[model samples]
Target: MSKNTQAPIPDSYPMTGGDGDYSYSRNSFYQRAGSEVAKSIVDNAIQENLDIKTISSSVSRNSFYIADFGCSVGPNTFTVVQNIIDAVQKKYQSDGLSSQVPEFEVFFNDHASNDFNTLFASLPPPRQYFAAGVPGSFHGRLFPESTLHIAYSSFSIQWLSKVPEELFDRNSMAWNKGRIYLTNAPNEVSEAYAAQFAKDMKNFLDARSKELVAGGLMVLTALSTPNEIYHFPVSPEFMFDLLGSSLMDMVKDGIISEEQVDEFNLPVFLASPEDMRRCIEKNGCFIIERMELLIPLSSINAQACAMNIRASVEGLISKHFGSEIIDELFGRFQKKLEESINLVEEIMTKRRNQLVTVLKRK
Candidate 1:
């Protein structure tokens, strides 16, 4: 944990409730943003010529073990899980095993403090698969070794286990003052964030490698920035800049102190495809089956895009700064986003990219 963090960093943030304070459940913006990328991963996996017999041989039991890492309180997760289950069932039928109905054990995993009640209660009644909640960080082991057959995560791995600690030390050149995230920070700050992401990805892949049986599959979707473009008009990093500027505005207005901004750094990183490929190769535990950049986030309108960003970070912000300032802060954020969009109307038509990665356990 960073020494400057006002609150202890959880493995990930939680989104729950339909009230005005926690509107993630009611808002469909995030689901809309991630839907295409997730569907592509599932569809592409099904299209692959997977040997059902070989995959089934690795597991000892008749039941299939599936886990959704970082399954927040959102409806999109349900659709993604169903798609995976359907693909598995289709493979079984194609192998002339349609007579057998294998029990499906689905696990929803997130940080310890995630709102398990809301997530579980919202489960589809009379569900086809057995459901259970597994609370732990995906950066470490959460299940017994060789116990899982399939793992899926969408729009989640971008979050680091915690903010880079070097950013907290006053003497460190990586101290990310005047910015809450690594959006427009100096070269040193960006490098520090990349280092932390590499470490976390290593831990994530190592743990998943141990838990999943040989030949098991893992699919992940995450936000990424364009390498050629420093600051694209409609990128995730640009949305982050709007957020950082909002906090600075509060500081100027005496609504919040500048030290508060300096002390807080977001525990998130937008990894590029090259970064992921390098990490996977270094781990040597998983074979990269497919890697592609999915739908650009800029396809969504600026207002909806802003809402998607708000749904993701509101929980983390409210936790640090009290719930009192939530409405005012986002209200300012929405207006600023509109201004930014109008300024770059011509360039805004381009895509804001995301990465979809597929790996098989070796």
Candidate 2:
């Protein structure tokens, strides 16, 4: 890979591991809820769009392969993969191929430092599918060519492979100074982030295209900022609004250096449906079969939402800002979040932009 597309560092630590209260497995209920909400849409997509007969017959008659990309140590990945397996079985039975139902193998993928031990230990027993853990950034290929029948990812892929290198160079126009996120960022900074997202997502699609057999299907569900919304301010990942402010507050108090603030930026990019469509079309390996948006986090309260963010980003934050400040930073975050509940309540009711897109490999 070129310098522009360099590999993500091995220690780009994933969600907090283990099954403890703060672990991603325990704190990621909102993502699991998203999987539940997306279940119907994914199942419908499989029944309506996945060329099951063609893929299974042409690819493998006795085994079906599925891969979950960007599968953190969280538990929701298990649910989403199971949903796909059940849906595929139903599709086969519906098409009078029940007798030929293939054995299922699922590949759970994530960053190399992800707690694969915990993920594997928590795997539900007597599962229908055989499970394997794959550790790597999903920006590039992990599996062999033309092997996967269905590729599923839920509430993932918003993460770029790494923070844009330009953001760290003071000489670069995109240097994000005094801010930790894209919200409230200048247009140039946001464009830099978007350019990196385009690169990461295109690499993702290209890799999946190579791994998926011809006529294979991919079901992807992710948090999206609709084209109409300037910044997706309502969701739990208001890392930009909530956590960034907390950091800046500390900066104002002289707890951390201004240069430290200038040097840091989250590697997440919340793309719109239009953005996803553009990237998919540009890759030219897959065609969108269905793209729709939904809102699913209304029931989660402020405190719960804060826990979700902490679980997802605590490792990354500690890596950059040291573990000593973690508690203080997130405490301010919770307080600010509770204080802003009214605005959040208003925005929650208005936006419906959790993007669920199903793609077919051409």
Candidate 3:
């Protein structure tokens, strides 16, 4: 389907992947860096009997379907699914429950526009496993009602569709050259983003609520910021600004046009814990069991963080700046990111990390 025709694919890129380009799935930086935090969440959910108990009680032996919403093509998916299986097996074993080993149907979902060929090719054999791709946004229904026992999404869901054009006036003015959606942009712009997030999240929870039997479980790990901050810039937009500055410098040097940079808008949105909690409560299905902040040491260092910043923006730079100038732009962009990181580090010691939440249906 065409990009315009498709509903917003949360956490998906505006463009398709090239041959052998599995950057979204293969970037071990996020998984390796975030594994410990992920493990703790799985361990806690098992220990506390968080949401699993609810689903386990309702479902027959070997009949439960466990879904990994937004499961990118990478080692993270395997790691998480294995962890869930181990947790469930241990639970059954300890209880002396002679129930047949649960048959797991793992649905690795993402946008239809995602690189499924790469994802499928990367997947290991499904010994005692059934795998399928559920394309489209998790915010919309992808599975039937009361079918899923567990759902998990990691390092995803923070992305929104491209910034809506109505956020700016029609006059085509450069209001905030270094800011996201104009530093002075109407609160409606921010609210528009916030409202979309709430709507999408509600759709996700509501759909899952219908699909999950009573007491089903959901674990979500995504990039979140403090609510009180009120105006913490979206990470992608920040990176975009960094890149835009570099592009503008090039334009001044007659390397590109102001129109080129003006045409771009990074697709990302970092929700806050409070925002998420409010949405969950509104859905009235899942109750938060545990929520923890996980900081990646690699991201904490200014230099390493800078590299990640570059990686995140690399695709957009290549698309907007053109292939010929991409390498030069990246070099300048990397230096600028390093400088930005240093400035940020001087005032802030560590990068705010992932927020891991485990919820049980109420």
Ranking by TM-score: 2, 1, 3
lDDT ranking, high to low: 2, 1, 3
Best candidate according to lDDT: 2
Per-residue CA lDDT of candidate 1, range 62-144, in tens?
88889999887757677778888888888778778887647789999988777677778788887779999999889999999
Residues 12-127, candidate 2: write the lDDT tens digits. Answer: 65889998878898898877877887889999998998887568655565878999987887578887888898898899899998888899989999878889998898898879
- As for lDDT, the candidate ahead, 1 or 3, is 1
lDDT of each: 0.76, 0.81, 0.64
Cα error, residue 175 of model 3, in Å, equals: 6.9
Candidate 1 similarity to native, TM-score: 0.91
Q: Which residue pairs does candidate 3 place in steric collision?
A: 146-211
In angstroms, what RMSD does candidate 3 have relative to the true structure? 4.6
Q: Which is superior by lDDT, 2 or 3?
A: 2
Model 2: residues >4 Å from true position, as ranges? 1-11, 232-239, 348-350
The Cα error of candidate 3 at residue 203, in Å, is 2.2
Give RMSD to native, each candidate: 2.6, 3.0, 4.6
Estimated TM-score for each candidate: 0.91, 0.94, 0.81
Candidate that would win on TM-score: 2
